[model samples]
Target: MSTLSADLAHQPGPETVAEGLLTMLAVVPVCLLVAGYGRGVQELWARRGAGQIVPPWRVAAFGVGVLTVLAAEQGPAHELAESSFAGHMTQHMLFLLVAGPLLAAGGAGLPLTLAAPVPLRRLLARWRVTPAVRRLRRPTTYALLAGGGQSIVLWFWHLPEPYTAAVDHPVTHTAEHLCFLAAAWSFWAPVLGPPRHRAPAPVAVLALVGTMLPASALGAVLTLAPAPVYPARVFGADPLADQQLAGLLMWAPMDLVVLVVTLTVFLRWLRQLDRDRPAGLPRTATLPGTAAVPASAATEGERR
Candidate 1:
């Protein structure tokens, strides 16, 4: 026991202690979410049996999302982000594209609902039908609000004035991350979240495509700039090169991520359409050696 204690315990400096505390703070929300989800899963398992509430893939996606957030906010990535424009862009992309969508698709909303107290759940149900809530829930309203919100947040934070402030200050930096994550989550929820909260696939597609325009434009501006926009945050000896690389990172990877997600949503929508179709309602039939029979002809034959 003494040997174990000695081996396990070591003196940590102030910087190490602060980093540990910040890491712990980052972990708190994830832990709370997991706990709530676990409780909900337990109840669901009792009522509906195992693996019926949330799909395995969704659970895996949530885990990956959590990992992505930790990686972006906590260790080497965070360190790199402090000094490098490209690294910061990489972290932001992970938050926006990977973590946000994956978490939304993980279907945690229902689980969290299930985890809430009965009184709170009842309150939420009542609130759901309120005018303000209904308006916010509208597909078009949410799509526009979400996309617009994310675009504004992204552009504002990337501006040299605000970006420099964020880099220089801890509180501003924290706020920047929160803004990015919240905007991203809002932008994706209607497309990827619980089915009850989701919007039509067409609407989601349009929202995503619209968002891409501004994002790509920003990236293009950075890539084509004559000099470094963020001189203090440059990592490499060639600041211009670093900024250009950062811009390219945002351009290519973000666009690819959006395209992939759009395709996934479209295909899933197609699948849902096929699934909801009436069974055994054939409009035409063809025998091995015969031409297809039209529905009208078949109906006429039946009438005769």
Candidate 2:
């Protein structure tokens, strides 16, 4: 323990300094998007004399998401990750579970789009209507692709060779983390994005459940493996035990988080159904912006 502490407390080497600088550069986009969102909120408030353009919770989520990512990348979590498999898993979870959903729930996309330069925003508007883009954004297609992509990325990085390469190389490490962030954010967006684009609560529940199974399977594999799947040198104390701990970290909290979210969405859906129920008629869950529409109309609204 003392040796580990000494290693971490040592003065930063040139390589470490360079890596830190590179990391800061990589984080620039997140900061810019956050700034843009704030700017957009201010502009909207000025133009409309409205109270908050975004809900206070959403703004708070955005700030906390940014902080979570920064902490995972640059704070003590990063230092601890160098010597411990469990610690590395902790950092990854912070990126995937904590930062990802928070940012998705922040509703920053609309504001950032609003804050974009006029020409860029106009270009995006034009691009969004393109056949390829439209197809990609379809609820069913988007959900499947995003969910599948995240699963694939998660599994691929956990593979022995890729994991070793990422750990050994600074650039690859950065890329791996970026991939995790992008995949996580993309996967969660359909469930937690701005109301205009959020999927129906029932659909979100399905997405969450689908994602949970694969993650749990991965965790089970790690926890049950007889031998350490990763390099022994990369982990603290007993590598096999650390690997198991990492597995449990991935399996237990992840399952709990997913189950809780799924239940919340399910309950919300039931509440909506009850609230909108006519005395004797049955109705399906409606999309966020289509609550006033007939259930039949909202049923295929996602396809539209």
Candidate 3:
């Protein structure tokens, strides 16, 4: 146990700790602005004889998202990542699968936009329609960019040169982290924040599938390779084992994340259908204290 601990543990850098603290501080103001401004808005509405409580879930989710990023980038994982593949994989999983989706679900951008000064907000809104931004507004294009861009970043960075560069160079490592987070946010936005006019659930599921297959395939290849593909064999641990662990981390855990997210989206889609159904009848009719039956069968049984 001591040996294992030694193999995985490392001295946490002051710089890393500071970076984490700073990151937290950066989000604090934005969150405060949102809450404060929102409350003010509510009060303003109250004066006009109408008001609504702000949704707590969205705020909580955003907080969790920021914390996830903080934990990955500035926590023990970041400190140990250069020395241990497990640590690196831990950070990757947190950002790509967890934080990104949470932020999207929480409406991360909404808070900032709402909190911004009126003129700045107007300017920002206008900027959304630029040619480059317009390209991203299309659902199909958004999904493709998110899934494809993420896959490229994930696979490309894991290559020997880039992987080693990320481990050895601070700038490269920061860039790598940013790219992963950006790709993740892009991928998750369509899944979490879909346009009201279209059914985004199917597209979201497809985007997730697109992400899942490529990531799992990459992990499988890495696992099957006889030797460590990345030159980041820093710790005294067995290189082969470290590499294999990283592969397994990506393989099993990535699928699990995808599966869980897929189920969540599927359930939400089911709920949307329920919401859309007409008031006169339940689509899947169930008699009092009986199993749910298909509408046709239920109607026939009632007739009988």
Candidate 4:
């Protein structure tokens, strides 16, 4: 405790809160622009009686995701993250695991594309089927790029040198966050995004579980390690405690999120299977301990 207190006492003063506030200023305008543009597109398409280009619920979902991001990035957490490892972890988890998924689930891609100008739209349409995109659209690619990539990035930046550098250098920190967010969005595509290119629920489920492995391992290692790897000495808390908190933050929340949503995915999977089944196939219960048998087989049973 004394060692921790001593470290805290030597801390430097914070930059003006205005720095965080300035970021908030940027976030608000961008969110408004997105929402307004989406609404405008929806209205334009609706007026033509051509149906909506972007659904209202999706825009609302996207707005929610954006607002959640702003709260994580520009709120006190952003400032505290600079000083406290736990705070930093909270921000990262919120952005990469929570808000990013919400944004993807909202299918912001559709609205953003629809909102683009005609020239850009034509370019995008041409690019949609390009070989590079087709390759990236593969389910295995989503698992590798999003699930594997995010895990690697999360672990890589937490290494002692990288952690120290990000804490010490603003640009490095920004890059770290951008990398995290990008990887996270990529990872979530199978589950939430590029809706037209959805991976099978089973595959998406496996990817989600596989993605949890590295992050959980890293968290466990950090939680059990003898010393802190982060540059938390100048911060106002015990580095050891802070590191443990950060580890727990990394370990539990994402897995819980996956667990809850995987259940939803499973139910959806069952429903999807039911829909895709041949017309007379017997439906299976989504819950365990139920078997599906052919209705015709049952109907013609002669005790055989």
Pick the lDDT winner: 2
Residue 214's C-alpha lDDT in candidate 2?
92
Q: Can you give the TM-score per candidate against the true fold?
A: 0.81, 0.85, 0.73, 0.77
Q: Model 1 residue 11 lDDT?
A: 65
Question: What are the per-residue Cα lDDT tens digits for candidate 3 across 62-102?
Answer: 66887787778767877778578867877888888888877
Judged by lDDT relative to the true structure, which candidate is superior, 1 or 4?
Answer: 1
Best by TM-score: 2
| Cα RMSD to the true fold for all candidates | 8.0, 8.4, 9.2, 7.8
Better of 1 and 2 by TM-score: 2
Summing lDDT over every window of 10 consecutive residues in candidate 1, give the lowest-scoring window.
229-238
Q: For candidate 1, write residues 238-290 as lDDT tens digits.
A: 78888999999888987898898889989998998988878876778566898
Clashing pairs in 4: 146-187
lDDT tens digits, residue span 1-304, model 4:
9999999878644544444555666567667657655656575666765435445565666778777777777678887886788888899998887777877766666556767778998999898799998788687676667777888898899888887787776557767877886787677767876556678788888888888878889889878989876555624468888888888999898778888778888899999887787886565333256566555565566467
Model 1, position 257, has a per-residue lDDT of 81
Q: Where does candidate 4 stray beyond 4 Å?
A: 1-53, 278-304
- What ordering of candidates by TM-score runs from best to worst? 2, 1, 4, 3
Q: After best superposition, candidate 4 residue 236: deviation in angstroms?
A: 3.8
Judged by whole-model lDDT over C-alpha atoms, candidate 2 comes out at 0.86
Computed on alpha carbons, the lDDT of every model, listed in order, comes to 0.83, 0.86, 0.75, 0.74
Residue 149 Cα positional deviation in candidate 4, in Å, after optimal superposition: 1.8
Off by over 4 Å in 1: 1-21, 233-235, 267-304
Candidate 4 local lDDT, residue 73: 70
